[model samples]
Structure formats: C-alpha cells, structure tokens
Target chain A: MTTTTTEQTPVRGGSFEERRRRVEAAAYRIRHSALNMGEVQGQGYVGQALGAADMFAAVYADQLTYRPEDPHWEGRDRFLLSTGHYAIGHYAALAEAGIIPEAELETYGSDDSRLPMSGMSTYTPGMEISGGSLGHGLTIAVGMALGLRHRNSASRVINFLSDGELDEGSTWEAAMGAHHHQLGNLTALVDINALQADGRTDSVLRTEPVADKWAACGWHVQRVEGNDVGALLSAFDAVAAEAGLEGRPAVILCDTRIGRGVPLLETREKAHFMRIEEHEWQICREQLTNGYEGEGK
Target chain B: MTAAPTTPRLKTSAMIASFADPGQKTTPAPFGHALVKAARENENIVGLTADLGKYTDMHVFAQAFPERFFQMGMAEQLLFGAAAGMAETGLVPFASTYSVFAARRAYDFLCLDIAEPNLNVNIVGGLPGLTTGYGPSHQATEDMAIFRGMPNLTIVDPCDSVDIEQAVPQLAASDGPTYLRLLRGNVPTVLDEYDYSFELGKAKVLRGGADVVFVSSGLMTMRALDAAKELARHSVDVAVVHTPTIKPFDAATVLGEVDTDRLVITLENHTEVGGLFETVASAVVRAGLGKRIVPIALPDAFLDAGALPTLHERYGLSTARIVARTLAELG
Candidate 1:
C-alpha cells in the first residue's frame, strides 16, 4: 500500500471536500498501522481496530487539537480508550498523532516493546487514562471535564468506548453522573460495531435503543455512519458546537462495521477478534490497496 | 427485648479536642479534619463515601468541599471504581466505606482498577476489625489478609487520631494506591508520647523491652500499650512495635527486634488467621528469624453482638489479654 499525502481538506464548518480527503487519508494510515500491529502480535483485535479507523482518524487528524511533543499539556483535550483490548486502534491513532514513532507499530505486542495487548497509561504516550477494566472511562472523563471547566479552560474530553464495554454497570452510573452534572464539554463516541469477544454483543447482552438510552439520560445525541469520514467530522463539529449549551452532555453513536475495509473479515461473524494467518494478511493488504467502496456494516 | 444503651457520656481530655469536634463526641474528628485540610490545600483533591461519611468522619470533608464530595450511597464497589476513575483524571480521590466492604465486596475492583493500575486512590475504611460491637457482619476481622495479597496496594493500620491525622497527607501526596484502616467514633487518643511521624512502609518502636515485643497495629496498638504499662507493675519487660503499614512489611524493623531469647506476640483486633498475626509470622519466618512467636488476636470465630467493651473483652482484644499473652509467652 502507498502512503498518499492527500490535499489538505477543511469542512464548511471549514472545507468539506478537503476535510473528507484528509480524513480518508488518515483512515488509510490507521488501517495500515493497525495491520502492522496485528502482524507483529501474530493475532489481535485487528477487526475492531480496522472498523473504528475512520472515527479514530477523524479525532486525531481533525477534532482534537494538541502538540505531539507535549502529551501532558494541561490544555490539550483528553482522549480515553475504555475498551482497553482495542488498544491496537489507539496504537494506530497514536502513531498518526506522532506521539509514538510510526515505525514502532511493528514492535507491538513484542517482548521488549512498550506496546502491550492491553493499554497501559504509563507505557503509552497520548493515553490520558489507562483503561483495561471496562466501564471506567466516562467517570474519569467526567472528572477531567469538571476540572477543566472549573479552571475555565476550553479543552474538551473525548472518551472512546465499545458497544460491548457498556455492559459494565459502572459505565451507566458514570453516564448518569455526567448528565446529572451537565458536563457539556464531555463527548462519548461509542464505536458501535455490535460485536464483543465470545459472540455478538446483542446476542450476549443487547444494548439496543442505545441512542435513546443516552438521550433519556439527558445527553444531546447524534448518530452517523462511523466509517463515513464526512459524517464523523460533521458529528464531532456539531457536538463541539452544542457543548456547554444549557449544560447538556453529548453522545455520538458511530454505527460502524467490524473489519471495515477487508471484505472477507468484514462479514465474518467472529470478527470481534481476529486470528489472521500470513495468507489472510496478504489478502487483507491486497483488499485495502484495491480501495473498494465501503462495505456492509 | 432489652433496650439499647443510651448515648455514653463524653469522657475525653483537652488534647483530644482537635479530634472530637465533629459533633460525634469523639477523638476521630482529626481524620475528617485532616482530609478537609488536605482538600483545601490541594484543589484537585476530592472525597467520596458509601453512606459512611458520618461513620468514617469524612463528613468534615463533605462540609468543607460540598461540591467535590460524592455520596456513593451504600455501594462499596462503585465507591472504589468511581474513585479510581477520579484518580485517572489526576484528581486525588479519598474514598471511605466500611473495611468489610472495601476489603471484601470491592476486593476485585480495588485490586484490578486501583492497585494493579497503580492509581493514587486513598481508600479510608471504617469499622475495621473489632472496633464496633455489631457482631461478625460489621467486623473487618480479615481485611489485612485479603488486601495483603493484592499487588501494588499499600495497607495502613493507624494506631490513633494522631497517626491518622499525620498519615493523611503523607499517603495522599505519595504516588500509588493505599487502604487505610479507620478507627472512627471515639478512637482512643494514644501514641501521644511519640512525635507521630509516619513513614510509608516503616514500623515504629513506641516502647522497647528485653523480654517480649508486643508487635501490633491499629487500635490494638493502643490496647497493647496499655497492657505494657500494666506489665511494668509485674516487672515484666514487654516492648511494643507498632506496624502501621501492613503491606511492604518492614522486615528489617520486625527482624531488628525479634530474638530467640525474647518472645514475639502479635496483638490485633482482627482475626488471628489472616490479620497482623499471620503477616508478622510469615515475615519473621521468611526472614529466618525463628523467635518464639505467639499470636494474641481474636480467635477464629464469629463474634456475637454486645457492648463495645464487652465484645473487645470477649474477643480477647482487651489490654488484660495482651498483658497475659506477653507474660505467658515469656515463660
């Protein structure tokens, strides 16, 4: 696959066409990085990583503003990964953000590398919270948002969660607390690929009417095709504008596909986790290069 | 059918006023007072309780920082999990619940979310061991054994109000996670003889003796001190070593005092099987210090409900039992 420097895009909130192109390019970068991460690990949650590539790309590339050199900057927006096993996605995103060397992606899950299968906050730069136990990010994000608002800072907090991670009751408690405090500066992007390890999330524990759940809890809700770079960019911009308006929090439901770009893996029922062999790896690389139209969700 | 005893008279001295001003008519005021002071100094500090603010004396923090305090409402697991979240966001969260719940109900979350991740969460657990007379249900008799096995968790068994007040900021400023056993509601005002400086993972020698070392922690340390004073009447030389930090056990301090000639008796208000007795015994054995060790702790049985003083005596956690144990072990 080639690394293309697409023309800089801005949305009409700045430049729509330019923003879409840059977002597509970012998706391509995250997908390639995730592939490299999975290859080094021999097996991983590559399917979910690939699925959430667009949302991750949209955030690191366009939404969040920060200096790669200063990850601990007080003013930088905080990004928390609640589904820790999906750290391969974050590894890809961090590489794109230049917090970690893009080449370090190949050392993922290696004996001596900093990248582990599960995310560790101290081990990884750009990880504001070390998340492994599910259902913890929203509460932490609430605290950071509260602190930031207290200090009169304009920085926002974005928490990335999996549909499956919502099974943790503590997550809902945090969601309730977030709305109760009217933390408008906090936005939670649920990468609703509808799959979790061991089986489909719905079959195991259905979290359907998910948007209504957030709305009923007092969050200003939005839904979008997560893989559509344009939609994701619009969703983020809309949420940012709505934040702190009458003190209502925001929840963007990103309806996404598992194993998004890879045709065979995208339809696989067990794509919650992937154990791709070397031959499968070649097929994935070829399919990504082909640049087929976005597949089924 | 008997009526519960009316409120006991407030029988404490002037030095204890710093600890008993929280309307509880007790010396446990310093625990909440210290937390309130720490919160005032550190704006990022927050307090949480599982319907235990009044019992743990964390109400002082609630009163001082009403917006920052979270009332978790009887859920111990949620209390720790939320505090872990608060800590992740760079907020110093001091969570208070009963020791039984913090050690038992929330053990997995405490070990995984807070300790394993090494978050700077301070868990202040009240009604530890035999401090209350509410029977086995309220007694946190085995908390030490339960928490000692968790990795990266610091365990503190404060002896009195002074130790608690001094240890609050010390634990909060230090990095990583800690579980502090609380002696709330009229905690004995002992340990005044010493300067009350508490170092993490360090044990202090309150009084030295040549015949026996009464190794203990928490409220039992006060009881042992009282026993030591009484033993002096019989000319029985008994030393007292107070180990506040249960985890990261001070092996050097423990071994420094252990000898074949002198007996080592561990006194605690906790269970004999898994609390201070087992901890000190394992440390002594692992360090190859084969002193005659006698454990002076509650017997392996569930205690029935009664008055606090009656229960302490029944469980053999009273000062008389400590003195008797030390004398018997010396023989």
Candidate 2:
C-alpha cells in the first residue's frame, strides 16, 4: 500500500515540454506574489525570494508529494526550509499551491499574520521547521528521513538550504549523517546565489568547490542552472531513479542569480537584503512578467 | 618510548565516579534502562545520540532497539535538529548528549527546533552541573539558567534512579518538549525509601521539619536529605522538598511547604543564579512572602576540574558542606 501511494505521487500532468511550461508558469506566479509581499513590508529578503522562487516552484509544483488541503498529513512528503528569510518565496509557493489563500500574500509580514517574514512551522502551513537561523533545515530533513524509514513509510524529505549555509559545521555534520544512515529518501536543494548578508558569499567565506564538497561528504551530487526548469526537472528525475538503491542521499547544487527574473534588481550592487525604491516596485513587476513571457519566444 | 607514569597514576576512579554516597545503594544506567522500558510499550519512542551513547547511557536503549537508535555523529545541533524532525514525523525521540553540548553548544537548535515548535523530544542532558570532573567545559553549571527562559520547554532534574525510572514514562507521555538533567551510571537511589513517585509539574515534600526547610532538586535532594539526618544529631529538625520539575514549577506546592517560622534553604546541582534558587526566590518575592532563602548552589564562577568529591566539597555541594552550611545558617 505504501509503495503504491508513493508511486502515485508527482501529479505533474502532461509531457516534458508541457511540464516545463507549467513549472515556469508557477515560478512566475511565485515571483509576483513575493514582490507583492515585499511591497507590503516596504523591504525584505526579496532578493532571495526572487532568486529562489524557481527552486521553490520545482519542489512545490512538481517534485514534492503533499496534500495541499491537508498540510499536516502524516504520510505527506516534508519540505523543510532552513533559510527562513526565504519565506517571501515560500509563502508565494504555498499560496500558488492553494495550501494558503493567494490574497493573504498582502499580510505576509504584518502583525497577527501566520506568514511571518521568517518561516515558522508553528505559524505557517506546510512549513516543516522554523528556518531563520541558517543551516538547520538539512539536519531536520535527515531526521525526518530517518524517522520515515523507521516507520517503513515512503515519504521523502526535501530540505532547501543556501550556499552561505555551507559555512556552518552542523550542515556538514548532517551531510555526513545522511549518507552514513544511507537515507536515499532525503534530498537537499542548495541555492548558490553567491551573495549573503555581509557581501558576496565568496567574499564573506569562500565556499567554492561547493559541488566537490558535497560529493566528498558522500552524497549523490548534481549541479544545475537553478532558473532553468528543464535542468531542475532532469536533476530531480535523476535523483528519483536512485531511490531503490542503497542509501545515497542526493544534493542538487543550483546556481541562481540574486534578484533573478527582474533585470533592474538583478544589476543592483547590493542585492543581499534589498530595499527597493517605492516607485520601482511596479517596474520590478513589469520586468518579471516581460522576462518570463520573453523566455517562451 | 613515552616517559614513565608521573604521580603514581591516581588510585581509583572514585574521584570521578558516580554521585554515590559511602555504601549507598545505586542502580546502574537508570536513564537508559527506564527509557528501554518506556520504548517497549511505545513503538514511537526512538533513541538518538551524538556519538555519546555509552557515555550518556543511551547505549542501553540503543542495544534494546538497534533499528530505533540513531547515531548523529559529533554534532549536537544535528542531534537536536533531527530529533525535532523525527518528532514532527509523529515519533518521540529521546536525544542524548552532554549537558555542555545540549546547553552551551547546541543552544540554538534546542531552542528553535525543539522548544520553539514544542516537539515531544526528550533531551537527556548528561553531566549536569558538577557531576563531571572535567571542569567548566564539561560541567553544565548553569543549564537551568540557560534554558529557563525558553518557552514551552519543561525541565526535569531527577534526584536518583527511582525518580528517573518514574520520570521517563511521564516525559514521554507529556505532549511538549522536555529536558532531563540525566543521572546515569550506577545512580544513587534515595527517593525509593520515601515511597515517592514522579509527576511532570509537581513537587513532593519528602520529610517534614520545624526549624529549617531544604528546597532542592536533582541529586542535591539526596545530599539535602543526608544533611537533614546528620543535622538531627545536633537537634536541627529539617524538611526536604523535592521540586524536580524546574519549569511549570510547582509554585503552589513549594509555597505551601514554606512558612514564617522555618528558615528556607534552596539546594540544587546548578549555579546560584537561574536555577531552583532563583525560581524559589522569584516565587517568594512575587508572592510578597518576605521570606529569606539561603541558596546552597555552585558559585557563579568557572569551577576547577578535579575529583567529583573534591569539586562537590569545594562548591558546597557535598553533604558535609550542606550540613555545615545548614548548621551555620541555624546559628
């Protein structure tokens, strides 16, 4: 029964091109919602939201197995967000998936809003863990994976972390543990945007040779263009193919651009924790829609 | 070849052995054994450790249920983070590590992952306070203070094997996150003689006295009880109140045990600040009882590493020091 249910997951309707378009469409909506949320707060970690929207799109729209109506279903796949500041993007994806109302995006960072600026599992639906203090999501994912394996359930654990998180020794600890425990059901999605709170990720702390590091720690590693839905879909497919084998947890290192899809914000010098001018909000929205539609042609 | 042994290689492990009194009966690995018993009934109970299974006595649980045990390497943060994850998956995880690691090293993970979400993860912190002889790095002298402010986290400082054997099932049965100051490895048994049973948020008065009341928790309760018996020879009638649950503190039970006549003394295996002493004092001050309390706790300083007995005596935690303090306070 578990095998049948697990196999019946991934409800992406249509062919490969059709699936890519569908993911692109979802990613566009996520980016739009994130901008709306940022407008409500006047500022946020919007650069990260804009950058990581595609990765969130691929997971929530295609790869992840969850019941949108029932966020707390025990048998559902777990998506843990370690980079809590990315809630702008996550709330967008949750709204896109219908787990939360789309109109609620306006209340993203307000008082009494379940959708806080930082992702808190207690407040937000479908958020498995509170992820503001970076480098925690992967460790929890390893635990959820181990627990699911103990229960003999087929649920997968998808942990979304950032490149800057690699600086944390605990992330490496969980990285080794995932392979040590042979949790094939666990997959890590690393958004390598090369920018952090201080400055460039490399300038702050050289986590170069990122892919090699994950491979050295005994993970089934893959690197892809994060903004490209086709590349992400293929990497996720490759990850799924290794499920029946001895546990080798997979990590897809996605290279993303901070302030992606919005060319005006993309060229900004300080994209980490961006504070856009009030008037540019509409321009940012127009660029996103134009850039997304331009990609199809 | 290495140089010959300098200083006669110290006699026995007595200096660093378990907190057992001379000829006092003890039960070995009480925490691990009791957890194994709890897991026997509840399949959702799983054991996890950060490469300190044997040291923390979680190895016993690991042995009983190998499939259920998770070795989280030497990462305290991951050990707790994973425990929270497992708890989110509807399984209760008994994660063990040193008190230093749980309180000092992995404070964020324990706070955000387990406490913030309030998962049912029983954090068994070994070597609380002066139990270990490895000085400040290993001893969690202010563990209670470090965790007292974290909302939704229940703290339990068990006195002996009996308290542990009873508290295990209760901590597991409780719905929220809980931290247990673990007493492992031939733990002394004292509460058994008093016919005491453990409850989550309640304090039990073991013995009644007229002149002095000793308010204590954790292994210090054993020392307080022994001191009471010794003080009796000097005509000092004493009362020992064991408030094991540190948070959701049984303030009413503790308040009822106090009065205007008897002198109150707060005893605990923690630093003078942010522990039972502070809790009792806070309760008294808020209630406007105007009662004074003589705190019998480790000094607010980095402690020296040596024999457990020597450290306990030096820190006023040994029975002799407790007796001396009580006698001096009486005069």
For each candidate, how many residue pairs have backbone atoms clashing (under 3 Å)?
6, 1
**Residue-wise C-alpha lDDT for candidate 2, range B1-331, written one tens digit per residue:** 5798765533225323677977999999999999999999999999999999988899999999998999999988899999988998889999999888999999999999888888999999998998888778888999999999999999999999999999999999999999999988999988889968899899999999998999999999999999999999999999999999999999999999875679999999999989999999999888889888999999999998777877788889988999999888878
Q: Candidate 1 — which residues are off by over 4 angstroms?
A: A1-13, A292-297, B1-28, B72-78, B88-90, B135-137, B194-196, B300-303, B327-331
Best by DockQ: 2
How would you encode candidate 1's per-residue C-alpha lDDT over A1-297 as one tens digit per residue? 011123211222248767777777778889988887788777988998989999998888877766677777666777888788878989998888878889888888888778888887768888776777787777667666766665567778888998887787767777777787678888999999887776888898998889889888889899999999889988877876776676878988999998988887886666666778877887887788676335321
Q: Which residue pairs clash within candidate 1?
A: A9-A18, A9-A19, A10-A15, A10-A19, A11-A14, A11-A15
**What is the iRMS for every candidate structure?**
3.0, 0.7
How high is the lDDT of residue A79 in model 1? 85
Give the range of the ten consecutive residues with the poorest summed lDDT in model 1 chain A: A1-10
Alpha-carbon TM-score of each model against the true structure: 0.88, 0.96
Give the per-residue lDDT of model 2 (tens digit) for A1-297: 133243435456578888888888999999999898898899998899888988999998887777777888777778889999899999999988878999988998899999998899989988888998988899889899998988989888999999989999989989999989899999999999998889988799999899999999999999999999999999988898874375799999999988999999889886677989999999999999999888763
Put down candidate 1 lDDT per residue, B1-331, tens digits, no spaces.
4786587533322211222223422364778889988887888788888887987888988998898887766656567766776776678889998888898887867876788779999999887887666667777888887888888888999988888888899889989999999876666677777655778889988888877788888878877888888999989877889998888889789778875477778887778887788887887788777666788887788876666655666677777766776676666
Error of 1 at B139 (Å): 2.8
